[model samples]
Target: MRIALLSYSTKPRGGVVHTLALAEALAAAGQDVTVWTLGRGGDAGFFRPVDPAVRLRIVPFPDGPAGESVGERILRSIATLREHFDGTGYDIVHAQDCISANAVDSCVRTVHHIDHFTTPELAACHERALTTPYAHVCVSATVADELAAGWGLKAEVIPNGVAYERFADTDPAARDRWRRRLGRYVLTVGGIEPRKGSLDLLEAYALLRERLPGLQLVIAGGETLFDYRDYRTRWETRAAELRVRPLVLGEVPDDDLPALVAAAGAFAFPSVREGFGLAAMEALAAGVPLTVRDLPVLREVFGPAARYAATPEALAAELAAALTGDDPTRRTAGRTLAARHTWAEAARRHLAFYRCLG
Candidate 1:
């Protein structure tokens, strides 16, 4: 089968990561796979090297005019991708995000999670993406249920696959390097965005710091097309009020990410909304203690592998336990859980779905 997987950006966001991994896995299964994405900010390729078997079509999307609203950017993104993408020969045209789903004439969309957009263009685009697709997929049953309840659309639930070995097999020397540089730290990925519950994490870290004075808060990996300046400004003001200074590493090298995850004393995932907590799963694979927001999707995905918390106070308590307690059974369960989600299995299931569409 000739499959074309479409994504909105070349950055290392979770959806883009899923697109690349699934494409590679499909190619490995002897299917012809081509990935289509817009090269935002003049990017020529993906954040990491892709497997040679999978073909790439990177459409150049130069920066928009200064002072462009996010809604304007969304419209331009769809037009630009629509202008460049030719899904002529693919047996399965799968779109991974709103932009690509809106850009294409018809496709099978993977609704990683549902979002409520206020921007008129963005809201319209989001609605069209959800309503227009011939078939839909979700990374968790919780999200699939959302599609069913809100839109009355039934979607196939296929969980994401973590690069289990990449993290689990990280060298001890590499882990030690991060520890030497940062000391004992609690880490979270996905930047200081509202959805990530960045402000909540800040509050929790402040509370935790009172007891664990030596522990640090580290944040990494925030790449997105939307403007979060207003939310970020609010976060900064709140951080100042809380008197906590988190080491904000915007984006780390992909090669060093596993070691960084492995070195953390505790991994924090306080996201208010998520399709799947890929980064948290990576932490599990790295044998790091995990704590996440008390969301149904996360509960379904992490099960006994992670600690759950609902508020800043609860998050702080969970993080403290994750750092101080030695629950070897839970740790073992985490590693086994992460190892069970393989890209090969995800790919096989995706192929079966595509066949059913025929």
Candidate 2:
């Protein structure tokens, strides 16, 4: 089968990660696959190297000047991708996000998460991306239910696949490198975005420090199409008010991320909303203690392998427990769960879905 996988950016965002992984999986299954993406900031390739079997098409996408509105950027992103995307002659065109969905006339779209846009143009684009897709796939059953309840659209639920062995068998020397540099730390992937609950994590970390003063807070991975400077400023202000100092590592090298995950004292995921807790799952794969928000999606994805909290206070308590009271049985179960989700299985399911559509 000939397939084209579409994503908005070449950055290390979750959706982009999914796009590359899925494409490689498909190629490994002996299917011809090509990935299409906008190379923002002159990025000629993905943050990490991809499988040679899967072809890549990186279209140059320059950033808009300073002070560009989020709405304008969204529109420009859609236009830029639309102008460069050539879906013709492909057996399937699978769009991984709203921008890619909006770029094409007909394609299968995977709604990783639903976003509420205030701008009229962006709101319309979001609506169209939700309603116009020929078919839809969601990463979790909770998100699938959201689409069903909100739009009366039924979607296939395909949970994300984790690189189990990569994380589970991290080199001790590499993990030691990160541990040595950061000391004992609570790590959170994804940046200081509102949806990520960055401020909430900081608030919780402040409370956690009352008992665990030796633990530091380390944040990594944040690449997005939208602007979040104002929200980040508020997060910074809150961090200051709470007298918490967090080390924000903008983007960790992909090669070093697994070791980084393995070295953490605990992984914190306080997302207000999520389609699937992929980072949390990776942490589990690494046998790292995890504390995530008590959201339905997270609960569905993480299950008993993780600790859950609904508020900042609760989160602090959970982190404290996870950090100090690590259970060998729970960690074993987490590794087992992570091992069950394989990219090959995901690719088989995707191929079946694509064949059904064809």
Question: Cα RMSD (Å) per model?
Answer: 0.6, 0.9
Candidate 2, 210-236: lDDT as tens digits: 999878999999887767889999989
* Model 2 root-mean-square deviation: 0.9
TM-score of each: 0.99, 0.98
Cα displacement (angstroms), candidate 1, residue 274, comes to 0.7
**Candidate 1 deviant stretches above 4 angstroms:** none
lDDT of 1 by residue, 1-358 (tens): 9999999998889999999999999999999999999999999999999999999999999999998999999999999999999989889999999999999999999999999888999999999999999999999999999999999999999899999999999999999999999999999989889899999999999999998998999999999888999999999998899888899999899999999999999999999999998999999999999999999999999999999999999999999998989999999999999999999999999999999999
Quote model 1's TM-score.
0.99
Number of backbone-clashing residue pairs for each candidate, in the order shown: 0, 0
Index of the highest-lDDT prediction: 1
Candidate 2 overall Cα lDDT vs. reference?
Answer: 0.92
Candidate lDDT values, in order = 0.95, 0.92
